[model samples]
Target: MTDFISLRNISKCYSAAGRSVFALKDLSLDIRENEFLAVVGRSGSGKTTLLRILASLEEPTAGEMRFRGKLCSPGNPLPSGMVFQDARLMPWLSALENIIFAFPPRERTAELHEAAKKMLETVGLSGCERSMPRELSGGMAQRVALGRALIKNPSVILLDEPLGALDYFTRRAMQRELIRIYLQEKKSFIMVTHDVGEALRMGTRVIVLGEGQMRKEINVDFSYPRPRSDPRFQRLIDEVLDAIGDGE
Candidate 1:
């Protein structure tokens, strides 16, 4: 099977205050089709930069990126949808409208509306569609953002700390919801997160970034609904943390 996403010796640098700073260093990775891959790392570890490169939101100073065997060039349209850390919704628009904003105005408007409604329901935000972003809770707004992404029906989804702002309970719930969506939709998911447990719970493979490089890759061979207290899970977390030089 062809790899859904491939990054070959990718590197990125930025000029700041007349000096060049490297954000990524010769990074290479492959994400298989229909796989849920989580990228975990400390602040400034290049996790977000990696996602941006994969999504074509940012350009790499060196190397190549491809999606589904096609070369990814600058300004190349992303084959995937994205959900950021913030909901990034149009505060002026209702939840439904924000979702519909991406759809082209054509004869299929009604069909798109129905599709958006179903996506909202899939994300467990059924009755709240008519509410504006200001009226909705943070979790609800994020759910709407997720719904918007899913409504695109892209082959891949890039999540940049999408659940980071939620409270513990909501975050846990969203983790389960993400897994369900991945299983039901069978779409490729690549997520950047700092939460180790979240990565372990939702990702079939976890890639650890550290010091501007891909440091480690781990596979969670265990089944879904993995227990945090499970000895193997805790052991894997410790190993990852240690790999990143985090003692705790």
Candidate 2:
């Protein structure tokens, strides 16, 4: 199948005290439909930058990014949603309100309310409609964030260090939740994570980056609920580690 999204020689630069610093240089990627792509790299390796560029939160300083062969820009944003390490939920709003917040003021009608309510249920936070951000646990709050993003009915979902803040148990649970959501939603998911195990567990394809460049791309042919105990699984992890120089 053809690529759903393409980034051709994309580069991003930052000006620091009149000094040009490159966050990403000559990075290229092709994202397909219904894919779970995981990006792993050390800090300053531009994993987050890549995700931001895909989310339309940041622009590439050079080269081009296209969704379905059309240039991506503010006027023509990608059909996608983004989540971050922090849930960033509104303190004052309830769970349902937070989900509906994704829609424009003019479109947040009774119908959207029903849709938002359904979305809350979709993320497994049904009865938490009236729960405030402060009232919910870390996992529940993140669920609300996911709802906000998914309520847009986006074709792709970009996540940056999602589940990084949760406890180990919550993180594992959320991982399962993510898989369930992905299987049901059938949306492309691009996640930037520091956890190799997490990436192996969720990603259908894993890309390793170093010094703002693509170092390797590994295909994970295994099924969902990946067999971490399998020898092939360990081999892939070791290979990714080697590519990342994490073995050191």
Candidate 1 local lDDT, 143-226, one digit each (tens): 888888878888889999999999999888888888898899888899999998899989999999997898899988888999
Worst 10 residues of 2 by lDDT: 101-110
Q: Highest TM-score: give the candidate number.
A: 2
lDDT of 2 by residue, 77-144 (tens): 89888888999998989999999888879766778989998999999998999999999999998899
Per-candidate local distance difference test? 0.87, 0.91
lDDT of 1 at 28: 85
Ten contiguous residues with the weakest lDDT in model 1:
101-110
